[model samples]
Each structure stands twice: as structure tokens, then as C-alpha cells.
Target: MAQFYTAKQRVTTKQRITVTIEDLDPFGQGVARHQGKTIFVSGALPGEQAEITLTEDKRQFARAKVTRLLSSSPARVTPRCPHFNTCGGCQQQHVDVVLQQQSKAQALSRMLSKEAQRVVAVDEVIAGEPWGYRRRARLGLQWQNKSQQLRMGFRQEASNDLVDIQQCPILTPELEALITPLRQCLRELKAVKRLGHVELVQADNGPLMVLRHLDALHVDDREKLERFSHKHQLMMFLDDGSENLTALSNNQPFYQSHKLKLTFSPQDFIQVNDAVNQQMVARAIDWLDLQPDDRVLDLFCGMGNFTLPIGKVVQNAVGVEGVAALVRQAAYNADLNSLKNVSFFQHNLEEDVSRQPWAAQGFNKVLLDPARAGAAGVMTHVVKLAPQRVVYVSCNPTTLARDSQTLLLAGYQLERVAMLDMFPHTRHLESMVLFKKT
Candidate 1:
């Protein structure tokens, strides 16, 4: 007996067509029109012709992959990394960095302008060295049973698989040099099967590595890690998925920003680009037009990146953060810098802070750097606080545009907006804006 497949039970066939890419979107996808419908091609660039295969079809638009390139754009450059196509680390490797920044800036301007109901021009696009700027990275680790070896690198794109990267060009030279030796050490470990992931960071002091494991390590394996750390002159830590860390060495890990030395653990969050961050901090401080008598409030202030610097120039500064660990670290950082005028508080930003002790003292200037979700409800508080100047730093444009309406309605003019090329060769966009009371 034979079975016949019905239309509903059959898999949808892929549609292939040739189209001209007219524009590039913020996500690094190429925009094209085919048969009166918009098509998004992943690996295609603007002003290029290519045959594409439709992966997803919808009523208004479709997603596609480039099959063959009929023509290439002048801006196209050969990717430096061998795993650029397969590794999910970077998306715009094929395109030059300058063009990449231009496209993102245009998208940001259009979105911010549309949301503000007025033409908003990007004052400047803050960019730094295109490559070797990523000071921190997390390399995924997986042990292959059949092969009896360890695989290390970034995860594969659109799949659970991993790409064994030999060289990552985006990492700083110090960190990239440790990749081979680090992998070899882990592969030789007796507890390799329990290995989870390896985090690499290059601090100004030295390189630091964190090895996350699911089980305990044998004494011999621990000795090997210590020897490796000593030989490489880097700090190493072992994590069992907790705040407690077993140090393999005795040196503290710290980085310098705006001439301030801040100590952070291996698992703590810090900006990956050191140069851009320092420049951004200088620009933000200058944009506020700081005065001698201004009392400042810094919200979502992770590790006192801005508050400590602001405190040096202002009368008093208060930094508030949601994470207790970060708040403690920020306060420690303030003391380390000998900044007695600055203070830190651990409070959830979503809740009203009017009753808090820190809120009793009014703030004339404010700064907030929120995650991608973009600080909602906080804008209303800012309005009530009636700060003369407010600085909002954001990583997601969609949320920034939505939140801008709140401040605009509160009679705060969007003074200046600058796109920060924090992560080059990737689609991540970070920007900061200044809002002044009308």
C-alpha cells in the first residue's frame, strides 16, 4: 500500500527569485522588492544584484538568503575572520566599517526624528578603531564524545552547533593570543566533560579568564590551571555557577576609564570597547555642561562608570542601581577614587524613589543608562523631579524612540543625539542624548 500526501500535510516549497537590493536595514539585512513585496536577504548588500531563496513568506514581506551574487558593491571588502560566515559573532564583516556606521546612523536619525515629530539630525557618530577593540569575549566550550576532544569558539548562526574558531580578529591581541593555549589547557584537563564556557577579558592591568564548570575539578587539574595562569601572567577563576569564585591567582582585575581605576570580578559587566567608552564618558560629561553647584543623579549606574567622574566636577553625585553587587562595587570604586561626595544606592528603577533617602535631596542634573528594555515609568519620575538637564543612554533604538515621547511631552527638548559605534562589525547600536528643560 502507498500513501499520498495532501496539500496541508506537505511542506511549503522555497521560492527563488532574482532582485536588486535597494537599501540596507539596521539589522544588516538587504532590502529588495520582488513582485510588489519586500524581501529581506541576509547576506546581500545594497546596490547589489543577487538571486535569493525565500526562507519565510508573509503577506507583507519575506525573508531570503542570497544564492548567487550577480554583482557586488564597491564598498564590499573581504572579511578578515575565516569564521565570519558561520560564526554568529559578527554580521557586517563583508561590509566596510565606515559604511556600516553610516547606515546605522541614518536609521537612528529617521527613527528618532519620526518619534520626536521634528527633524532630528545626528550631531556626531562616535566611532573608534574598527578591529581589535573588543576587550572582552565569551568562548563557548563543548566536549565531543566520539572525537574525544574539546571544541571552542563562538556558537554557530541560526543553530545550536558551534564553530571551532582558529583566530578571532576582533579580540584584542592579548586575548587572541591566549585562545590556543587556553583551549589546549582545557582539553588536557581530566574534567573536560564538565566544562561549560570560557570567558576572556583583557584589562589594562592584565588578561583575565573565567572557566565555568558543572562539577568539581581534580587536584591535578586545579594545579594545572594555576600553572597556566602563572605562566601566562593572567588571573584565572573557576565558577560553579555562583557568586563565589575560586581564584587561581592573587592579583585583582581592574580597568581604567576616565583616569579612574575600578575593580570588577570576572563575571561582572564592563564595556567591551575601552577607547570608545572613555571617549563616550568624556563626551557625556562635556555635554551636561557641568557647573560647580549642580547636584547630579545617576540611574542604572553600573559600577559608577559616570557617577564617579561626574562627582569629581559637581557638588554632589548619587548613583542608583538595581543590582546590589554592582552598587557595592560602585561604592567601593568611589572610595578607591577618593570621591567622598559620591554615594550609591541599590533600588529598582521601576519603583518610585520619592520616599527614598537619596531622593530627599533634590537633583538638578540627571543621567540614566538603561538596558535594551529602555527605562519606562522612570521618565515620569524625571519629569516630577524636574531636573534642568537629563542624559539618557540607550542600546536599543526602538525603545529609545518610544521613551523619547515621554520626555518630549514633559517639555524637555531633545538637545543632542550621537550614535556610539560601541560594537563594530555587529548590528548592535548604542546612542546617548541630552534633554534640557524648556
Candidate 2:
């Protein structure tokens, strides 16, 4: 079937309207009500008046971007990044950091309170330096055929287009200094057309680099990358979209959490904010109130971030991960730390875990740091395990609230919840929850 649009159905010019910003929503957009319809205004802050141009329209709500700010909020701050408006790397840089934390904490509390069918408030907020705290970043590459130039930066807001950036304010100082030189180096490569993206990480030892290439690099291009690595004195890894990563240096990158060093490959997952991560680990351990005779089980334990620390204080610590590679690395990290009481196991938490060898043992204290999807498949098993205490570290609050239902129904209490200001100047929020069977 074919359809044709009539004159009435033809595209019309954008609609602009004036509205008073009421509040900031979960995604950091300003909330406004216009003629009884909910309007989400971007680049607008609470307690501000603005003229907005509609970007999206629906029956119940509409999305708009501010064209003119007739008024501004007292909490508004000047954004540090020049690309902050166009780049999608961060969203809340224009808003005050303290207000950002307050808004997010309120939202998190409401979400958890509703999910748990009881009042749940954030007991504490773990925060650090609002800028230059990020230890990891991935910049995209867009190669221009006619100009033979490679534009390296983050993606544009809500688009695939790259926002060419000289430096990002959120990245650590070490990684930030390499951005211009890295862009220049990528443009110098003969295999620019095959370039994918570049990942930078600020390890405790030094900065690290990873280049994702669609195809194998030429001899000269590889040498050029080597020279760049040599000049910066950072470890370099070339990823060909596979498990086999080509390393240009023998040095391994490592980071510290709870005073334990965790060695990981460029492929492994590590927290982007080192300060918040360390504080978070300490808080979780403190909340658990670990006893010397107790045992702890860490779910979704990647490279033994929390598991290694738990091992030091408990009689035994068992770390479980779905990825075999991470499990192996977690075990190696424990061994490297000389923690003989710690063990790592690889098992899919989505499946029946009672049948697994690791689940046969009794774990009095359990800590699970699942990804954004949350531990839906393992919540029942976690409840069944009958752990006296559980510390859940989550990157997504909706999923955290969703999974907390099982714990609540199983007679566990939401003791303490903390909002982790892990990624400032962004809508992304991380949290730590303590559930104790008291």
C-alpha cells in the first residue's frame, strides 16, 4: 500500500511558545505546563521563563529547546565545556552541581519509596570534585573522504554526527591533555578510513589508550601509533572488534579501590570516577558491618572491585561474574593482592543458581553490583540465599527500585540508600542501597 500526504498533512514550521520552567525532570530537562500539556524544555532551568521551539510533539506532552531565555534561574551556572550545548557527552553542566544532586536525590527517593511501598529516603550523598573526575572516555571518529581528515570527538546531541572537540572538561587532566595530540595523531595515520574510535583511560600508573579499527593497521600506521604511545608514555591497545587485542606495550593498567589494586584490560569494565568509586566501596563495606567470621558473596563482580576488599575483612569472599574473562581477571586480582580467602566463579545469574557449585555454600553477607538492567533474574535467588545483609550497587535507579521489591517482600528492610554523584554534569546516576534482615 502507498500513501500520499495531503496539503493539510504537509510539514509545517516549528511552533514556538513561552513557558515558565517548573522543575527539572529525571533526564535533566526543564518541566513546564503549557495550556494543560506537559512541556519538556531543554537548556532551560527551574524558576526560569523561556521561549521554546518545539522539537517533538505528542498528544499528552511535547519536547522543546529554548530559543530565548527571558529569565534565568539563580542555580544556573556557566558551562565549562564549549561543546556542552551540542555534545551529548553531558547534559546538566549548565545547572549548579549542588542543585543537580538534590534533584536527583529527590527523584531517587520517590522512585524507591513507590517501589518498596514505603518511604525510602537517601541517607547520604557521596560526591567529589564536580569536574575533571572522570577517568575514562571514548571519543568517536568520522572520516571525511574529500578532505582526508578525521574528526575525533563525541557524538552530537541526539544524532550520529560527531562534535569535534579539542578537550573535554569532564575527563581527568591527564586524558584531557592527550585529546588534541590524539586527534592530530589519528589524522596522521594512513589507515584513517579504517579507524573506528579511540578510548582513553587514566589509570593510577599512567594514562592508557585504545584504538578500535575496523581492519588491520598498516605497518607505518602501527608504528605511528607506537610513536604516539611512546611520546605520551601510555599503554596502547589496538582492538579489531574481537577478543584478540593487540598490545603495543607490556605495561598493564591498574586502578585502586578500597586500597586494593585491580589490574584490568582495556576491554574490562571499570568505574569512570575513581574518587566516588573508592568512597562508594568504603561506604558499602561500612554499611555491611562485616564480621571477621562472616562470608560475603559479590554478584556481577568485575575484576574484583569490591570482592577483593571484602576478602580482607571477612572469613571468605566469593565473587561471581557472567563473563568468564572477568572471572579469571577477578581471581588473578585476588591472587595479586595475596588474598587467599577470596575466590571467583563464572556463572550466568539469569539461570537457576541453586544448581551452581558456588551457591552450595552459605553466604551471610551478599553484595551485588549489577549493570543498568538490574539483577531481575537473580533477585529471587538472592532472597532464597537468606543473606542477613545485602549491599546493592546500581547505575540505574528504576531497575534498583524494581529489584528491591523482592527484598522487601522477603522481609528485608531498606536500611540505607546513598546517591552516588559518580558522573557529574550528566543525567546518569549511580546508587548504593543497604538491605538488612532486621
Candidate 3:
């Protein structure tokens, strides 16, 4: 008879185990094997030996927290963030930055090769400043009853407890400078208890701070926020459970890429890293080898981030998005930029959209920038369009690999691929790949 063990029973049985780290998982955790079972250990790097305590035990694999570093890897470095050990915002800060990029690129290449069943050569690793590149961040807020103060910062690693950090190195200097003043302003608000989350964005025009609250702010609270905005020379907005955003200041928040303007709402999705995004958009345009007469399709296009820029060079560009609001904004951006060749349509790409009018329009090139849930549903319809080239921009390697297999099966050959270091000191990997019809 086979024996089974509960998580507690297994931990009590093993207590602690020392093992050599073999490799790293996509999340940058050290991978090790013990007693014919896989163990994932945090804060341990490849080529290191560590003693770990089991935190979770499953039938297939177990999760552990490193207790002692028996042997340290050469590539390991002291993390710069003072709260690196506690803050959950970053993962690879302990590893050397160059080594982190190389490891990520290798992992991405391996995934693509395994999924597509062909040798995938990574062309280049697109990288920029590793720190202070993040232009947007959402911070958690909590009232400490004992101190009668508000705790503001990111959450703890793997826990919901907010880390009271005074400054974050990952955020742009303009946004980081407001951390202290923002906290002070929140403390003065009578509706501070109603505060849910704080979002800070460094738009191209200026900095914008958004305060989300579960309840409406009092008149005094709004005045306090306005003062803070004026003092910091930043725009302020309030979201009080209403679907619309109420501006406390007259400034509008927007960002520019490729000489094109893009206005976004406080809650709308935009790439957090500005420099990396510019390079990514340029690469996508170059890889498509777009021509004056070429018609292009951009799937999951958000607020014309890529659509308006690509529309400038192509004969006609069509962008499809799931959210109608974003589609409306994209169209507005096209008209704002005087790009008449671009058009946007609202359609849920997760379902069959082959019957949609835009789907029937022949496009010689297609660009995909889907969320972590890759573009599987839209790929079938895309195949029907038979675009000559397909460019895939992925945030999740696992999903990218899954969708790559689908594309390979549809007679598309994976030609060029690269990794973009969009989020440094983090496990998140942003990559781009080009597929050409054989």
C-alpha cells in the first residue's frame, strides 16, 4: 500500500533538509531536488547549497524558505533595497543585474524551444537603466492604531502586511520624492480611514497622484489633497467608488512615445517602464518591416500605445481591444495625433471574433500584446487572416510558449526573438518574438 502525508506531517517528518541548488524557476526561486521530489527555495541562487524549511508540501513539489546558506553562488549580490528581504515588489535584487538578464534570456529561449520544438536563438537582450525606471506604482495604505499614523508602501513578501517604506528606489525620482509628503497629507485627511490604495504615476506632462477611497472624501480632505498637489506641483485625482475619476487639479495626465501623444485614465493599463516601452515599440515596428501600403492589425491594443505609432507608417492600421472605453480612447488618440489611417474596434479577443468586420479585413502583418493570458483564442482567427508576419509581445513566458506552439502548428516559423528588461530586480519577464510564414 502507498502511504500519503499531509503538509504538516511531511514537514514534521523531514524538519530540515540541506540540498544543492540546481537551477532557477521562472519566478527566480532556486530549484533543488530532495528525495525524488522538487523543492523551490526562495533567497537561494543556482550553484548554491542551502538548508531550507518546508513552507508548503504538495504531491508533486514542495515550497521552502531558506534558513541557512550552506554555500553561496558567485553571482549573488547584496540587494540594494533596504526592505529587499521583506518587500514583495522585487525578487532578483539579490542576483547581479547582468546575471539576472542573462538567466532570464536563457530561460525564455529554453521555453520557446521546448514549446515550438525548434532551436530558438535569442537575438538580443533589450535593457535600460535598472533602477528608477518605474513611472507608475500602486501603494497600499494602512492605519496603525498604536502609532496613530498611516503606513504606506508595498506589501511584505508573500504576505499582505504593508511595509512602511519611506522611499522606493524602483520608482522614478519624481514619484519617489512624493512618498514622504503624500503620507503626511494622508494623515491630515479626516477621510484617511476611507483610503483604500494610492496610485502614483509620472506622466510625460508631470506627476499625477490618484487616491482611491471606499467612501467619499470630505470637503476638508479634498482641500488638503489640492494643497499637496500644488506643493508638489503634481496632479491629484480621487476615485470614490464611482466609475469615473474626479480631478482635484486642472492638469491632465498623459505620456508620449515615438512623437505621438497618449492620454490615459488613472485606472487604465499602461506599461510601467517608459524607456523599455519606447525600445519595445521601436523594435516591433522594425521587425514588422512595415511598408507604406501594408495593412496591420494590433490585438489587445491599449489606448493606441502601439497603434498610433504604427499607424503613422503603415497604409492602414486596425486596433482591437476588449474594453470599449479603451477603444474609444484609442480612436480619440488617433484623431488627436491627426493619424487618419488608424481605426479601433471593440471586441472581446478571448472569444471567436472571426465574424467581426475588422477580422475579415486582410492584414499583411499582425501584432499581439495580450496580457498574461496569451493570445490563444485570437490566434485561430489570426491564422485565418494569414498575415505574412506576426509579432508577439509577451509578459508571461509560460503562456507565450503555449501560444508559440499553436503558431508553429499553423505554418508560422519562429524567426527572431529577444527579451526586454522592462522590470529589473523582478521575476517578471517581458519578451518579444517575430514569426514569419514559411
RMSD (Å) per prediction: 1.8, 2.7, 4.3
TM-score (C-alpha) between model 3 and the true structure = 0.94
lDDT string for model 2 (360-387, tens) is: 6888999999999999989998998899
Candidate 2 Cα deviation (angstroms), residue 246: 1.4
Choose the strongest candidate by TM-score. Answer: 1
Q: Global lDDT for candidate 1?
A: 0.90
Candidate 2 stretches greater than 4 Å from native: 1-13
Better of 2 and 3 by TM-score: 2
Which window of ten consecutive residues has the lowest lDDT sum in model 3? 6-15
lDDT of each model, Cα atoms only? 0.90, 0.91, 0.90
> Could you give candidate 3's per-residue lDDT for residues 114-219 as a string of tens digits?
9887779799999889989999999999988888889999998768899998888989999999998889889889987778999999999999988898887788
| Ranked candidates (TM-score, high to low) | 1, 2, 3
TM-score of model 2 relative to the true fold?
Answer: 0.96
TM-score per candidate: 0.97, 0.96, 0.94
Error of 2 at 364 (Å): 0.9
Q: Write the per-residue lDDT of candidate 1 for residues 195-261, one digit (tens) a residue.
A: 9999999987899999999998999999999999999998999998877988888888999877788
Off by over 4 Å in 1: 1-12
